[model samples]
Target chain A: MQEQWTTTIRPVSGWLNINLAELWRYRDLIALFVRRDFVASYKQTILGPLWFLIQPLFSTVVFTVIFGNIAKIPTDGLPPMLFYMAGIVSWNYFSSCMTNTANTFVANAGIFGKVYFPRLTVPVSVIIINLATFAIQFVLFLCILFYFTLKGAPVHISPWILLTPLLLLQMGILGLGIGIMVSSLTTKYRDLTFLVGFGTQLWMYATPIVYPMSQIPEKWRWLFALNPMAAVVETFRYAFLGVGVISTDVLAFSFGMTLLIFCIGVILFSRTEKTFMDTV
Target chain B: MSDTVIKIENLSKEYRLGTINHGTLYRDLQSWSARIRGKEDPNSKIASAGFKVQIGSFMALDDISFEVKQGDVLGIVGRNGAGKSTLLKIISRVTMPTRGEVKIKGRVASLLEVGTGFHPELTGRENIYLNGAILGMTKKEIGRKFDEIVDFAEIENFIDTPVKRYSSGMYVRLAFAVAANLEPEILIIDEVLAVGDAQFQKKCLGKMEQVSTKQGRTVLFVSHNMAMITSLCTSAVLLDSGKLRVRGNTSDVVLSYYTQYSGSPASFDFRSSNKFIGDDHAMLISGSVVDSEGNVANEFDIRNPVTITMRYRVTRPDHYRFIPNFHFYAPDGTCAFISGPQEVTTESGEFEAVCTIPGNYLNDGTYFVGLALSSMETGVKAHFYEQNALSFNVKDPIDNVPTRNGYAGPIPGMIRPKLDWKIRGVA
Candidate 1:
């Protein structure tokens, strides 16, 4: 009885008590969840982690044939394989994080109903796991970049390549923010779950994944730059191939959007985590 | 606040009867606009008591307040659906309370169900780490107690094997072992002891005792087993229909619950009942206990005979024999004996089975009878089973006779038959 607890439980009034320190204290749990998610998904498959590379590799070939060769999509003078692979890898990471994080509530309701942990740990682990997957695919992209360099294709490595990690970080935060917000909303309105997958697919075409940002007419280019992912993909292309749009305006707009989405996503997720069990 | 590990004040929870949020977005939007326009929602009307309510809510836990002192083991006893689980859920933060507050000292770990987050593909060692992390233990804490946990579970031989490959008993032991080793300041345990063997239960009780006494941790234990509650808990609370019925010393609270439970009825009405579990090939119409002359009796003379009459209507009776049975339970909740009809017959019409319990065979105490109807075949399939259908008291009054040299306290054991004995004087 000498040392008293500094903890109390009361009905939540409105916004969540977003305790960053509590989330920090649960860092090990987030790490284990990340490990578990990665290990369990590919445990019995013959291609274990090879699926990570094979997924984007196979998709890039299909995109090259359909969109590059037949559709006559301009790749800004970069090799079609290089162009498509970049889009595929970056888009795959964002979509997977979004889709998985969106299902975090319905998927883990069983465990959450029986135990108490920082609910934010679940979504944080999803982001980290998807980031690791992106790293693996990035290695594959480097190998392909090496082959093209030896063959002397006009693939200029710009100094802007130093900003690739920043681009990926922006995409990660944006996807995570939307995913958590959707996960919370879908608890009360289950129709949102059915729409999230289809919405993510349509969103890929809206970004510059299939076509370069230069292909858009000058008058409509401002409208296209509003998509935060478009900025990330275009900058990623500009950083590596030195042929796509890169400006202070696009980067500043993307950062602003990512911050807003991430904040709202966390607030919604933390609030829903308290009473989602009652509805779910 | 420092002396009390858990302080609950006016805690309550209300649950909607059916689908959450009115089951559609249209109704939700309606309510939202109503709030925006500063008007009462059209759907927020309370139903009168006499009418059939369409969509309504009930309070599972209603304004209950209590506290648990540091290092005190408090037992909560109640019948099923008495808001016991709801109370624990609110305290553990699995769900939030609808109103009021709870303040606690230090970390709290609740084991509502054992092995809650165990993945089947993970090995026992991996699962221990996973479960420990879920319960708020750091990786280093689990690693330090790894060997101690393995030894306590007695599953070192299968530690490396996947948990799915372990037998259910082994799985339970491993899960319980991890939970018992958690060194939280306050621990909450539900009815997880009913799964393991008796020996394992005893071990868990011993470990819990150590956790509270030696380590000075506060514990809140919920159990239906009064014997266990009386032995392991320092104090107890009795809940009845979402209210705190009584709270005091463990033995005193248990006695209050026992007396309240046995004071109900000598017969159960088969009508107006929905808590029945069976295929319903046949249904129990009525059941009661009576003397040989057919008078309803709640108090039986130990020297006489008592008959249990059960009336059931059979719908499908062409296949096998209908066996009606009675399971006698002593006051401490142990099955005393099971008696049923021996001769077999096939009958389809409504029938009554009267089985006589010969007196002078049972001890002087309160006894409860449970009814069961099964098909008397090679593989006995029970059609229906009902618990606590009828309860009665048995008393033995000596008339100008001396027994055990005027010993007047009470006799022990399930039966107190007067067996013949021969004694000789020794020089």
Candidate 2:
């Protein structure tokens, strides 16, 4: 029924031309992994997915107590609770993605060594699952947003809400970029694993999540927004509370930095996927 | 013109053994020294070996090159640490080569180990998609073949159960089904069939045959099982300590492997000091099986029957009830036969325990023999023999068996002793 068939092959010139068809081939796997990440994280847990809401909610209360009252950090004229919630939600999302993907090789070495699949799917699914959790947390922000709106509180859901999707995109890409960069590097240098936890902690302060960009003196304000995550958090507050600083310059610079990091990260990741097993 | 689906020019890999990496604290000092002196750092051995040697660093593979046409199942036979897995990893794109290049066409899938992409907490169905995707199979491809995979794995009910709950057998069955169903343009497997029950292993071989022979997918299989290689692969290559030992017909390459491991009898350094086996009654000080050439030949051919001479020292034969047990194992770790000296004499003595694997009885492959002097009457083993005792290889006498089957890996229920066959009626 079949005649003999054979084909010739050549070394792929370079990895620049990543085949989209191959990725499309694994679309269901991406979806399944995302679903598994989300479902499996809460499986049989007493709190279940409610933990998603609880995280930002609890973090907001803690920040309101420690930073809002204890440290006397200003929330840029908005209610301390809402101001901290926005940052917590977004920050946690990226942190989760980073944490999930950073261990890609160490966690799945057994599988990666055994079978061949586009290695990116594992990290990409982390972004998807964390994004879903962020959406759940976003609903909590809305409940607070509505309460403040009804209380005749001074607030505005700026038309800048249109750009919230951009924030999500930024979070996804930046998380993936940094996560992959660290994962590819950590395959050999495991010191990064220990550093990541504390690093993310210090990184949150650098992002202005508990304080406002305005709290910095005018001369020092430039340094505040230079932190890519700082600009993102500031802009998100500007959109929801209409009270934090927002600038095209800050967003554009952050975007550029994010794009650069992602490019470098993906390049390193692709190169490492070939030989990660040996080192990891 | 396009028959060669795979082509290699020069391939090599090096691994550093006994290497200790310099601590990161010394990084600045090393770099500073290199920059100031315009010379390499003194401790640059490991790093230089990594970048400089490429494949030649320690040379796991030294300039190996070969081609496999579509539908050609290529077997890579090598000893442990011989770089067979490294070659497969590079070709599969799971790992890059230290030197040379591999050009792969078509989608590739690999099964270097069972449950490669499985998440312990994920159910079998979820893992099917995850593992399939990891193997580069599209969702539609996985969906189209989902039922077939489950059916073949015989884990339909368990498909919804978390894979962590699955037994090792179920895990292997499902893993193989997902991998085999990928139907890649190129399938690279590395000793995954070494596990699993006999029936499942047979199914796996049958599936591999169907994938390569029927589906026309090119297969690159790495294994220590020469019987499987000889039977399934159309061509073969042997690697010996990072170099191509032989490359040609499957039969020739397998023979080359066997012959190299089949040590020469002329160089017997008698009193060569074989392993010790004893139970306080009798202890084996030294012994060796000399071939027909009157030299030490631990390994023999399928049709060759030889004598086993042993020298033992008996210490106080009274109340020291023990027997010398000799076991014969097929190459795939299957025991062909075993015999004990006390099967006849319940007495202990400085005796020579000799057992022969009757001629034409064991199907060709490697075999291991172990001598255990144990208290047979008391049923308490005073001493145990392990991975070392006695070992040998049996080569296939190709003249008799024209065609062989690929189902020759770790068969369950030991004693692969070949038995006489007769058909009373054709069912």
lDDT of 1 by residue, A124-175 (tens): 8999999999999999998998899899878888888898778888888898
Tens digit per residue, CA lDDT, model 1, B26-86:
7888888988999766555442343445777888888889989989999999888778988
TM-score of chain B of each: 0.63, 0.68
Task: Please tell me what DockQ candidate 1 reaches.
Answer: 0.43
As a whole number from 0 to 100, the lDDT of residue A250 in candidate 2 is 84
- Docking category of candidate 1: acceptable
DockQ of 2: 0.31
Q: What is the TM-score of chain A alone in each candidate?
A: 0.97, 0.93
Best by DockQ: 1
Give candidate 1 regions above 4 Å deviation: A1-3, B22-55, B112-114, B258-328, B331-333, B337-427
TM-score: model 2 vs. ground truth: 0.78
